[model samples]
Target: MTSSDPGALHAQTLSEAPCGRRLFIHALNAASGEGQEWVARLRELGFIEGEPVQVLRRGQPGGEPLAVRVGVSTFALRRAEAACIQVMPADAS
Candidate 1:
């Protein structure tokens, strides 16, 4: 991935993305059936690829289960669960 190329930039996992920065769902990094489950679950929760999300809060000042907003719904997720979600800056190409 190249920093200068928005298209080439590697997607950031939701667990590592800075709080308050809007992100676009880019991919699901889970493996095989696990990935499908995650993708289905996320989709059921309104978190499909190309949708916008933002980190709304953190747990225990610094812990798992980050609270995020997708569309008009807000939900909390553990770091491991969120790690499967790859995202890009919302305003990026």
Candidate 2:
């Protein structure tokens, strides 16, 4: 991958991932308190390592709610929640 690519050798948070590119779950960033809850919920929703994920669409200009598909399930996640998911490009692995 090129240097400009966010998922070249490292993981990028889902919220900052470019739309329409197929990516894979690299890791989950679990913070304290509510952030941990979000991460846990995300895991329960099938956001796991090695799983394929894609950014279907984004909300308006600000890009708050992101339409993301993980495996065979799609979810609408806010930027904050999406940030909990760390993903790498499909070819990274």
Candidate 3:
């Protein structure tokens, strides 16, 4: 919440979220075409508003796919996909 950028507190994509951080879904930036498919898939995976999400693991230094826990399920997402999930720090929420 102390981040210089106010949006950093209110909203930031999961890709930028630190590992082991617990957060809440603020919104999902569902897009068209390929992203539209991801949006639908993510929704089916239970990436919805108000639900808690946690960054469990991440790819090595490259940081490609990130493993995350959403609700009671765990899934791996590419940084591009993770970037569409906007969330707020758990404490702030």
Top model by lDDT, which number? 2
Among all windows of 10 consecutive residues in model 2, the one with the lowest summed lDDT is 1-10
Q: Which one is best on TM-score?
A: 2
lDDT of 1 by residue, 40-79 (tens): 7887898888899898888995676899999989999988
Off by over 4 Å in 2: 1-8
- What are the lDDT figures for the candidates, one per model? 0.81, 0.87, 0.85
What is the alpha-carbon lDDT for the whole of candidate 2?
0.87
Q: Is candidate 2 or candidate 3 better by lDDT?
A: 2
lDDT of 3 by residue, 1-93 (tens): 345756555798898889998999877876446888787788889999789998898988898789999999999998999987889988786
Better-scoring candidate (TM-score), 1 or 2: 2
Listed in order, each prediction's TM-score against the native is 0.81, 0.86, 0.83
lDDT against true structure, model 1: 0.81
Ranking by lDDT: 2, 3, 1
Error of 3 at 34 (Å): 2.1
Model 1 regions more than 4 Å off: 1-8, 31-35
**Model 2 compared with the native: what TM-score?**
0.86
